[model samples]
Target chain A: MAEPILQVRGLSTYFFADEGVVRAVDGASFDLYPGRTLGIVGESGCGKSVTARSILRIVERPGRIVGGEILLRRHSGQVVDLVTLPSDGSAMRQIRGGEIGLVFQEPMSSLSAFHTVGVQLIEAIRLHSPLSKKAARARAIELLALVGIPRPAHRIDAYSFELSGGLRQRVMVALALAAEPHVLIADEPTTALDVTTQAQILELIARLQRERDLAVILITHDMGVIAEMADDVVVMYLGREVEKGPVDAIFHAPRHPYTQSLLRSIPSVLAEPRARLATISGSIPHPLARPAGCPFHPRCPDAMPGRCDADVPVEVSFADNHVTACHLYTEPVA
Target chain B: MTTPVLEVPVLEVRGLRKHFPIRQGLLGRVTGQIRAVDDVSFSIAHGETLSLVGESGCGKTTTSRCILRAIAPTSGKILFRDEHGDAIDVAGLDRKGLRPLRRRMQMIFQDPFSSLNPRMTIAEIIGEPLLVQGMRDTRERETRVADLLRLVRLPAAYLNRFPHAFSGGQRQRIGIARALALNPSLIVADEPVSALDVSVQAQIVNLMLDLQDQLGLTYLFVAHDLSVVKHVSHRVAVMYAGRIVETAPTKQLFTSPKHPYTEALLSAVPVPDPRRRAHRIVLEGDVADPSNPPPGCHFHPRCKYATEQCRTEVPALTEIEPGHAVSCLRAAELSLRGVASGS
Candidate 1:
């Protein structure tokens, strides 16, 4: 395998609140190879988004990266630890959009309604390159065209509010790719889109990844999406990675009970009509009062009373790349 | 699945149309009509779930709202069967006349968070419907609320707790219990589980299925998620630009769709299995604007199988197979692909 462009090891991001600290991204680890897509799959509050924010050094106020190393290998082959740098510092700012671009879920909220799409695109373009306003505007049009926005020249002048959801998302993709970043982090990029629109967006992302050889971190709650787009899958539960493996291995031979139950529980168009879906027993626990040991123990059908509740299980390797953090797979301590 | 004996449909909608006037200028002059629900028709048999599947602004929500009388239809009939087995045209009913029928057909909203009142306890929320129906006795309401809670598989002890105390799934259960409070024969669920997590979604879907089996409830399920629609529906109607393009049994819709739009929709749904990553039919453009849709077939602009005739002439929905209807001009000739059946 080619060398990983970005390696995240034992990443831990916490949110300090009045009540208590939230372990939003607790000890997550993954490798992102150029031209390969890594999917972070999890339900809401599972820390998938926080992990992305942590990597970008954009964890909002009240939140901080407490531990872990985000190792990024630059074009010169010099590796830098992203966590050690000040989030607002020049170097971090340069790397934020210069090397790694982000696409958020809600384009409406993330985008400035006051400005036209061209302004935002040109600003992003000029930040990463030494281009004048006219040249940057030209580059912005090219970016929009690259992301498949019809009549990019005319559409560039329209405000974000004037664009449809699909078109706005296309603009977001255009902005993200404006910097020619090596890695793209799209957090729930298509969740807000309709099915047909989602298909189009997914196809666009896949095509862009192929064209640019981009290392992509696609975060979503939809397993269907992971199956369709991800080369590797990381399944999270309550901020912790419960399972990680090749997409085929993770889908066909899942190790973690949560992953298994999740795959079974999702209503599939391919499934037998009117068949009752197998359900995971309980809902996700509140972030403040996260359970001890395994977070998913309360809902997991295969949970061991003492092992899964008293002590956290370490990741157990089952195959070349297949691994699961569960008491079911871990050896019992004497 | 054993087929139920044929009976008079619990709800029948014929040529339903809902058009909102697009007023322009300072005088607020009526310029044109945005046909939100245009000439929609379907029937939901007793204990059957009929889903209206479409994208946002495709008029699925408008159709459901029109059926529930939450919004008045511009024209056509909404025939709802009463407990006495007489089909009452709810669309023609005056506000007073529709009052009794309202209790017989209730609506379940999409967002459980906002659908529920935060200040009210579960008991109060569930008992609100019973109270409106003239259940004056507090003790009786409490007992009925308790029963409703149990019916949705929630603990009776949580009756005193407010909506904030529950999860999205639990709040949805509460919403379902409230909708069931009146013992309505027909339920219009508008994207009920779409707001929930995948795991929580299954539990709610199963609960709804179990409730339908137990209570013989008829469901007019409106949602955009094709997978959930496939799982829950007995029959499905595919809508585009305020009109239904196709209607078929759930199995037929999934295995062998006749309409190009339905085929694209079924193919668009991402299959969970990575091994089955097939080439998807990416629709070229956005859904047609309801106010200014294309002259003939609304879907012709994006449909791959569109021909010259499809662009110039309107196609009326015609039945090619029994229990399966499609509106495309080349419905008979087009061998559109569908998702292969079985998990």
Candidate 2:
């Protein structure tokens, strides 16, 4: 592939909690190309959300990005290191909503209940631009229409609560698309909606990608959503990326044990009734007790005895695009 | 069935309706009624798992609550078969009269954290039911709790631990053990695994299936996830508004659905395979309000196959095949699409 639009390298974020320093996101890396969706899949405490927040410098209190570079290839063919930008500086502020638009899973809470949807959306537009109130409102209505909310002109004035769950998510999408961003980061955008509504939101995202040639980083825990939306996939476990590969390679022939267990565990629509699913041996380890060597050593079926516990395993590329971090691959099966 | 089914069904419900009055103003007069569970009827066989699958406001939870008599249902018949092969109208029985029958039917709730008390130990929570039914021997109750712990694959050593000591999956197991303490023939699990992660959900689903095989327990599984439903259920009932739109064997219904609502729901689910980007049938609007549903069909406003007749007439649930039922006016002529069978 040509030069990626966005490159994330060795991104590490830690939270200085009272219990201990939580390595929420440690040494994560990935790339996103134009018009392709990069899916980051993980469970609740696995730090997929923190990785997204790291890109925008929005990691909350007590959480800080200690190291790594977020390289973005600007439209002018110049590279910009997002890590160096101040957290609340004007340049970083423009990059937050202007260059990279982000949407969350729960639109009801992300959106303010006291304000009208129109006001919130226009506020986002007027923040970075010199447009008048009327012009910003018109742009906001145009965005609502773009996201497939019917009668955008009329619905724009309605408060967030007045809309249904699907409509609220659509309005959230409209707010994300307020500025013509080159990359969209949607973190579990459809998890809160019903299945039918999820399908619509997914289709809308795919269509927008086609129309705008945008690079997308789609984050979710559901394998089915990843398969449907992503062109490349990152399987994360315990704040580290266990595998990253082409979508077909990850789904059709996964190299990591965690990835394989995840697919096997899902009660796929393709599964037979009463069919038993294979489960990982233990739940994810508590963050305070981050395991030594390999994070998945406790639950891995193919873990090597002394080798897996000795040192951290670095990624090894098996194919052109597929890479996995496992000790069994390095040490021959005993 | 032609064999007359030697044993009575574990549970059966008929025309269950629960309407909550919307009161307002100083007089607190009833302005309108929210038909939470409108006319609904179905039966669960001796060892079958029948899943009630629908969106949130489609009355699945209300139906479960009505069956358990948590809140007295406005009207209906909850026919529960007793150990003596006698059918008892659970809905009609008074609290004093229903005490004995309550031991034969139990409910497994959806939220594991809130379902179990934090102060209570695992032994107390699981053994509370046996004690409530007049078991005075503490030694026997403790032994039974150990057996229940083994049944759910949890360590018996966890007996003295508080609910907070367990993980989400382990908490759900404790809830299941509590539900099974009295050996009820019927268990109503309302989204038992919806709150869990994907891997943990499989563990609980497998445990439920194993328990059913070992104990011959019948389950009325309530969930909105069709994919999970297809895995554990023998039959699937699709609900819309407050009524069941379709009921059929899980395989038949998933592969060749007769109801348009079911068809759309099946299409809406994302196929895990990247090879099959399913063409989804996205309904155009939100679910209709239960308080003031449309004149005829509640779904006509968003249904793709709605006709002039559908707008003026309500369709009754009719049997199209041996065990397949649908409530659609165009069921006879509409050749709807279904997912191709087999992985």
Chain B alone, TM-score, model 2: 0.97
Which regions in candidate 2 have their CA more than 4 angstroms from the true location? A75-77, A331-334, B1-7
Q: lDDT by residue for model 1 over B1-343, one digit each (tens)?
A: 6445457888889999999999999999999999999999988888899999999999999888888888889999999899999999999888999999889988888999999999999999999989999999999999999999999999989999999999999999999999999999899999999999999999999999999999888899999999998889899999999999999999998899999999898888998989999789999989899999998999999988888998989999999999999998998888888988884
User: Which pairs of residues have clashing backbones in candidate 1?
Assistant: none
Candidate topping lDDT: 1
Instruction: Residues A96-122, candidate 1: write the lDDT tens digits.
Output: 888998998998999999999999999
Model 2: colliding residue pairs = none
Assess the local accuracy of residue B267 in candidate 2 as a C-alpha lDDT between 0 and 100. Answer: 90
Question: Residues A110-206, candidate 2, lDDT per residue (tens digit)?
Answer: 9999999999999999886889999999999899999999999999999998998999999888888787788899999999888878988999999
Q: What would the TM-scores of all predictions be?
A: 0.98, 0.97
| Reference contacts reproduced by model 2 | 0.62
Second chain alone, TM-score for each candidate: 0.98, 0.97
What stretches of model 1 exceed 4 Å from their correct place? A332-334
